[model samples]
Target: MTERPSLKEMRAKALKNPEVKAEYDALASAFEMKRQMIALRKAAGLTQEEMAEKLGTKRSNISRLESMSASNSPSIATIENYARVLGYSLRVGFEPAAAR
Candidate 1:
């Protein structure tokens, strides 16, 4: 059988592995959440400092929450608190739901 060479090709092969696919899926979801948080903060017309004050946190903390590469993620409870402070509620549901 033929063999594939180079790191890029090996990485591409790894993507076909179930474990690798699952890891990618999880990472994508995490990034999406960070994006959503950033969008929400913008839509509320709140500076990071303003949002931090409303959340009882520091601006840096709010900054970190919007960063996917950050080592720390804000707790779900903290996100819920921020949503509540902005008079919004967090909702999670399956996508492409069928009619009830």
Candidate 2:
């Protein structure tokens, strides 16, 4: 048996394909948001269950939110609540769309 390719290697290979690269670019914001949320929770020393308790939600709900798909949009109110509980604030902004 051969050793498996590393995640970085696999991702680099996947990114070479135009369609896959486009899809990844489209979902980049969602991935970054999830990363920041998880980091915030860790920095606050809170487990997902603890965070959910503070937010008055279930651990599974928190899990689902953290693992949300790019197509599944969360409400501003929901994001605001999460940020408030995490000792942060939510700020929304827009950028000019990329030229096709």
The Cα local distance difference test for each model comes to 0.81, 0.88
Query: Mind giving the per-residue lDDT tens digits that candidate 1 earns over 1-58?
Result: 8775999888889999989967776688678877877887889899999998987889
Among these predictions, the greatest TM-score belongs to 2
Off by over 4 Å in 1: 1-22, 93-100
Clashes of 2: 0
For residues 1-100, could you state the per-residue lDDT of candidate 2 as single tens digits? Answer: 9999999999999999999989998888888988899899999999999999999999988888888554577788988999999889998889987775
Q: For each candidate, what TM-score against the reference?
A: 0.64, 0.90
On a 0 to 100 scale, what is the lDDT of residue 99 in model 1? 48
What's the residue-level lDDT of 49 in candidate 2?
Answer: 95
